[model samples]
Target: MSQLAQDRGISVDHGTAEDLPLTTNEIDLAALLGVIGYVNDLEMVFSELARVVSPDGHAIVPFCGQMVLFAELYDTAAGQEAYPDTLDWKETYPLEMAKKATWRDVEAVVSELQSVGFTEITTVKTLTQPIETAIETVESPSKGHDDGSWIVVHARRE
Candidate 1:
């Protein structure tokens, strides 16, 4: 990841989310996209985000694969067996990886942001691309479907 970021000239640094290598109230904006899917300590991560970003800065941050398959998240409740409306897609990777990763939906992300004291919070425009038609609405999910497949939370540091 560092190599890729470096190649793109994005000043990427390796550090823990709980303890960021940055000063207080230093950053104007922090684009934390798709982070909670990997980290279990959501509060700590947001705390760090809040600490690093300026008072008005925001962070974009989760997941059902049907709406956003980029993360390849596997949920028992979202499986074909459970959700009959779930689309039929073959497993792309080993089941072990699925077992290890902790999957989190948008609701969880929103909860974390609220817990972190983010008041001016609003979910960004959810784009369930390729899968959801341009005319379709994500708010009202289709049959055997789930809304808020992907979420990018833009939360202002109040």
Candidate 2:
């Protein structure tokens, strides 16, 4: 992916957190946008973010939650029988996991990031409405449903 971006004239830096090739405090902004959920250890990544980012440097992370309606659907459906564990479901139904962003879980992520030394938490709530209202307001003629909502939280490493 970095190579593809480089082909488009974008410079890329590649390294693991254990041996970050970038100089300390060199990154001004870190966008974990729509990514942290896919990681095995979110807290570890946040620690890396704190280590690499300068004071007041921004880290924008967009993650999904567990309380999303589709997740609820999975929880209430055969998924319970199919996977019996969240990890199994995550692997088997990746799209569902991707779309299952929720407030409670995302806030937990925020708290974890804060504990890892990132601060100045700011959250943006996007695409939220009561399920019933969403079902009624959706204009698509083919189908109508309320699948919950998503959020984008922006924070900084202090």
Candidate 3:
């Protein structure tokens, strides 16, 4: 990952979520994609985000909710799995990493962000249907979290 960033002239810093290796107010944007489910200490992570991001900056967090897991289980039981093709889509960390993940709901995420001094919270929902239909919604993500297995939450640091 660092190599790819370096190739594009982008500097990358490595650190755990609870103890980010960054100075206070150091960055204008913090993207926590696919991170909420894996972190054991969300409060510390959010605190670090609050400390490092500049005031009025933004944080974007994308996550797959627990409902997705249920759907996958259902598909598997029906012998119609939907994730086989995606398993090798990218080289990822070991499967052991999944053991640490705990799916969180959209409201919980929003509340966490707000507790950390973030505001203007909004959500973009996707994956409300099968892959084909879901792809179409990507260009115009629905508002709110009533119908999506995947969601992206956008918030601004206050």
Give per-residue lDDT, candidate 3, residue 91. Answer: 41
RMSD of each: 6.5, 7.9, 4.4
Error of model 2, residue 116, in angstroms: 1.9
Candidate of highest lDDT:
3
Q: What is residue 23's positional error in candidate 1, in angstroms? A: 1.6
Q: Which pairs of residues clash in candidate 2, taking residues 3 or more apart in a chain or in different chains?
A: 64-101, 65-101, 65-102
Q: Give the clashing pairs for model 3.
A: none
lDDT of 3 by residue, 7-50 (tens): 99998888988899999999999999888888988888999999
Q: Number of clashing residue pairs in every model?
A: 2, 3, 0
lDDT tens string, model 1, 1-158? 89998999999768877788889988877876545556778788888988998887776663333334533434443342232244343433344444445556665667777887676666543434543242243453322214445555667777
Rank candidates, TM-score, best first: 3, 2, 1
Q: How far in Å is the alpha carbon of 85 misplaced in model 1?
A: 17
TM-scores of the models, in the order given? 0.63, 0.64, 0.78
lDDT of 2 by residue, 1-158 (tens): 99899999998888764345676788888776556655666677778888888888888775545577534544554444454343323234443553443334766777988997787787665435553344345433221112324456677877
Query: In candidate 3, which residue ranges exceed 4 Å CA deviation?
Result: 69-99, 131-139
Give the winner by lDDT: 2 or 3. Answer: 3
CA error at residue 50 for candidate 2, angstroms: 0.8
Q: Model 3 residue 111 lDDT?
A: 92
